[model samples]
Target chain A: MTRVVARVIVTPKPVVNDPQGITVKQGLATLGFREVEDVRVGKYIEVSMEAESMHEARERVDAMCRQLLANHIIEDFHFEVDQVLHRDTHR
Target chain B: MTRVVARVIVTPKPVVNDPQGITVKQGLATLGFREVEDVRVGKYIEVSMEAESMHEARERVDAMCRQLLANHIIEDFHFEVDQVLHRDTHR
Candidate 1:
């Protein structure tokens, strides 16, 4: 089995009200970050899994994102999966 | 001034205890996702800014990440800045 690492990014849909983002924007303004604008906050998830192939890893991670990592009603998710080389094997 | 978008990723230090991640892992297991392991949760932030140059944007975004976007005491942050071209200019 190949060890795979998946990085998933989940963001609120454009129309969704992002109070957290707004709060952060206000905080930035208070901190004198005048150039900053349109700040949005989201979630980043990293998961490791064992799979038979890259294709399998990708499919599994995608399913995981859709089913558990993100809320389909208000969020969108994107992910990338990469194989990990075991240290013992690399030596 | 040039419009630039900055994408910042902030992740917890390896030594930090990630209760959120652990809870997610347990939830996945309950859902029969046995292959999932080593899950970590973090923050992803998108910031748009107006700057004189790419170099200036990068520097400003870096400072924002250091001062406001991330908690440096327990998290590490990385960011990328890219220029945004006006739609009218492209036409």
Candidate 2:
């Protein structure tokens, strides 16, 4: 089994009120930033795992999110899984 | 000026207790995931901005963080600024 990295982002739905996100966006606008938009705030999860394939890695991460990483009633989560390349050090 | 993307991740220092991260890590282990470790929880900020240079873009984002994106007393933040690639369509 090889190491895999999963980056999970959890955010509120568009219809849901994101007070934290809004607060951050408003703050940005105050700092002379005019072009910022859709400033949604979310969580990032970095997990190193050993999985045989990308599909399996994703499945494992999906289960992790549903069970604990995110509060399903009010939030949604998405993740990207990739294999970790270990560099060989023999020259 | 070109568009820039900033991905900011804010997390508590390692010495600080991270209940959310610990909970997720434990949950993963329970589901037969043994290789996961140091699962830190953070935030991702995707900002589309027009900046003249990387230094200027970073300066703007740093100001944003100090003003709002992260709480200075409880959390520390790090960000990556990259020029956004916009594909022009002409046939």
lDDT of 1 at A81: 88
Top lDDT hit: 1
Give the per-residue lDDT digits (tens) of candidate 1, residues A6-62.
Answer: 889999988899999999889889989888778889999988778899998898888
Given candidate 2, what's the lDDT at residue B23?
A: 80
What C-alpha lDDT values do all the predictions have? Answer: 0.86, 0.76
Give, for candidate 1 chain B, the lowest lDDT window spanning 10 residues.
B82-91
iRMSD values, candidates in order: 0.8, 2.5
RMSD of each: 3.1, 5.4
The DockQ value obtained for model 2 is 0.45
TM-scores for every predicted model = 0.93, 0.67
DockQ of each: 0.82, 0.45
